[model samples]
Target: MFKIGWLRIANGLIYLYILAPLAVVIISSFHPGEYLIFPPQGFSWRWYEHVLMSGRYTEPFWNSVKIAVVTTCFSLPIGTLAAYALTRYDFRFKNAVQSLFLSPLVIPTLLFGIGLLIMFSALGVKMYFTRLVLAHIVLTIPYVVRTMLASFSQINRSIEEASVVLGASPARTFWLVTLPQVKSALAASAFISLVMSFDELVVALFLTGPGLNTLPIMIYSDIQFNLSPSIAAISSLVIVATLAIGALLIIFMQQRTRKSTDIEDPKP
Candidate 1:
């Protein structure tokens, strides 16, 4: 009983440690003062209003959104197909191929960013947006592949075999039978891709050129030159947005799981 109590206390302390900074940032964002300070001088939404009205972050914010969307769009189908192939088929050097797809997860982000920058520079590629998207695709594919691989592995192969026995083409079986089983995994992969691409800073830092700013870069620049409540406001907005998205995704996944369960085991 004492050990269990101590573990609970430890967990509570850990959560507090993680959340304390977020609370401080959210609180500081409400400060009405020009300079940001902890235990804010007064409470106001001026910073949030300023953030909304100010044109400073608008373009970068949209840029980040655009990049994240594009990255997810490209990453999802490619990763899903790769994952399906890897999980369903036994091929030459199967383990090696899987490891290759998953290598990005093990590689250091800094080194990957640097390598991409160098490769792009040497190739005389100057399209920052395209380069960034491509880099993001590479970085995000591993996550998608990993997620879908697990989902695909868990699926019953007998169902797919039955579809083939019913005269369904491989493509038809994949589309109508196999894909439906892993819809939740697809959503998860897309969400992971979107969030990772949106929040990625190191790769963006290396790839972004003049006139190609992202929200993170803008926030970083503001932090370097001017420390203001607006920074905290923007950060708070990001935090809230991330949390909301996560909550929505969780709800979506839960609904999907419930519906799938109902379909699989309908009651008369």
Candidate 2:
């Protein structure tokens, strides 16, 4: 009982530590003063109103959204296919290939960004949007691949084999049987890819050129030059948005799991 109580206390402290900064930022957003401050001078929504009306971060926000969306679209399918291949097939240098895809997670983002910048410079690649999308796809694919690999490994091979024995083509079995079994994994990969790509900063800093502003870049620039309550407001908005998205994804994955369970073990 003592150990369990201590563990609960420790977990609560850890969660509080993680959430403290977020609480401060959200509270600061309501500051009536022009400048951001802790504990907030007084409660007011002026900053949020300004953020909504000024349109300062609007374009960059949309740019980030578009890049993130495109990154997810390409990364999810490519990563899923790569994961499926790695999981379902045996091939030469398989471990090496998997390592190569997941290398980004271990490598320093700054170093990876620098390497990409150098490579792009040598190739004379100047299209910032295109370059960013490609970079994000490369970075996000490993996440999808890793998540799906675990999910796929957990699925019963007999189920997939049954589909194959029932005269379903390999592609058909994959699309109909194997894929449905891991819908939660797919959703998880998609969420990770979307959020990572959207919140990406280091690579964006190295890869993005002028006239191609992203929300992170904008926030960074503001922090450097313009630190104000509006910045707090925008940051708070992003935090809330991220939390909302994560909640939705969790709900979606739970519903998917429940539905699959009901299908497999229906009550009489």
CA deviation > 4 Å runs, candidate 1: 263-268
Candidate 2 per-residue C-alpha lDDT over 152-205 given as tens digits, one digit per residue, 9 for 90 to 100: 999999999999999999999999998988989999999999999999999999
Clashes of each: 0, 0
What TM-scores do the predictions have? 0.95, 0.93
After aligning candidate 1 to the native by TM-score, how far in Å is the CA of 248 from where it should be? 1.2
Stretches of candidate 2 exceeding 4 Å from the true structure: 1-14, 264-268
In terms of lDDT, model 2 sits at 0.94
Clashing pairs in 1: none
Q: Best TM-score goes to which candidate? A: 1
